[model samples]
Target: MTSTPDVIRGIVGVYHADGGLRGELAYLIGKARGTAHCGLCDVTHHALGRRREWRELVAALGVPVELVHLNERSPAVRAASEGRTPCVLAVTDAGHRPLLGPDELAEVDGDVARFATALRGAADRAGLRWAPDER
Candidate 1:
């Protein structure tokens, strides 16, 4: 977890149980449906930074990731994606924006690490912070 206070840019709110991400992140999670398949899926199930790459991402972004299982999501949840699955979204005070789709992440046959790195870059640009557990 980051040594600095959980507040990112002075935005104060509750965090999710997965890590200590801002409460607003939850809304974004709820808006999306369908968890993207990644190398860390089996281990972390529904988290953003379950693996090493993701850890670095969370550390950088300072927020916890909540992955929704698209295959398992009901039609209602699918509405959030508007039929776009396996895409990265950046949530902000204005609204959410699409970063990439599964097609973009799939690098030379499901290179999840490469995809993660790309996501890390995007999150980094968005000022996301990394929040690791007590290690």
Candidate 2:
């Protein structure tokens, strides 16, 4: 049987513009019952954990990542379905596309190393920052 962590690493799903992913993350954490907490750090940790789990699963299972948009589909969707991991959907007035930040692009060039690099690059490009857990 697959462990919880292993199961977490194999899920692939779509994120809608209406904050579906965030909502799903919250739901997942909430389902943990006593394990869930009201503290900010706790919430953030849970969310990040979910995100990491999703990413790992997509990578391990070769699952496609997709983004929802009006009319046309995002290139990232195509790339993801084509077996690209760590793909991003950038919503734009023109349309969405599969995009990688410098780090993500760099990571794609190699193997597993690309995951961290791409994540860092994507965070940098998105003006977001991630810190390791205190534990």
Candidate 3:
């Protein structure tokens, strides 16, 4: 794993829900006892090539990025998802912002230029520096 930037002020983390055995169990539990959990991180488990794309894109901004497994029970992730998974969240000094969903990203159709523009906008909205050195 690449190291977190020394001047870190934010994280562009992606949270993915599970769609496997654990997911089924979580569903049943949530139905019964009202809780949840995830089996895997979708972006890491699938999207083989796009993982590199996501990494390269985040790397350029000089901020930490993480691919984390998310389930409905995780309050922060749940609040971030707001009903969906594979959500990109900008957790910054100012606050948290749910930037995109996997489906929204797919709409960009592998266009890094478009993705970067959106990311920069999110950074600005979250009061984070796209160029950490400038901060």
Candidate 4:
């Protein structure tokens, strides 16, 4: 295995739900019925909309963070995220790597602070370092 740290240039998050209006509606209904759950969603959003904590976390990360639904994910993301919904990917010059999986995300339980901590830990474990700010 490559032990050298990869310079993380960006981050990608894949939600468990599909994209588009119908998919969103279905996810909402399923969520209401307790049949569908996305830990990433819980961390990033609330009933009112995107959480302030999430925005702050993103800003502090000093990297581009892109969140996408199931249908919105690229083929590469789909492959890395296959069978693993609600996950986070680390983007590096080496390519994308799985940074956090569903179970890890679920552990955060809607807390942005916890998620940030988890992300930092995961990145370290994965031999990743955030890219230096261009500014």
Scored by TM-score, the top model is 4
Error of 3 at 115 (Å): 1.7
Model 3 Cα lDDT, one tens digit per residue, 1-135? 333332235554444444468864665576357453222132323334345655576667666666555543346656766666655776654445676667655555546667667666755664555435432
Q: Tell how far residue 82 is off in model 1, in angstroms.
A: 3.0
Task: Say which prediction, candidate 1 or candidate 3, comes out ahead on TM-score.
Answer: 3
Worst 10 residues of 1 by lDDT: 9-18
TM-score of each predicted structure versus truth: 0.43, 0.25, 0.54, 0.95
Clashes of each: 13, 4, 0, 0
lDDT of 4 by residue, 35-94 (tens): 999999999999999999999999989999999999998998898899998999998877
lDDT of 2 by residue, 1-135 (tens): 322211111112222212356654664566476443222122112433544543463444332334332223345454442443323443322233334523344334424344445544554565433222222
- Rate residue 93 of model 1 by lDDT: 38
Q: Any runs in candidate 4 off by more than 4 Å, and if so which?
A: 1-5
**Please, what's the RMSD in Å of model 3?**
8.2
lDDT of 1 by residue, 12-122 (tens): 111112222543354356535533233223323334544554455445554444455444433433444555555555544333444555455444133445655666565
Using lDDT, rank the candidates from best to worst.
4, 3, 1, 2
RMSD of 1: 11.3
Residue pairs in steric clash, candidate 3?
A: none
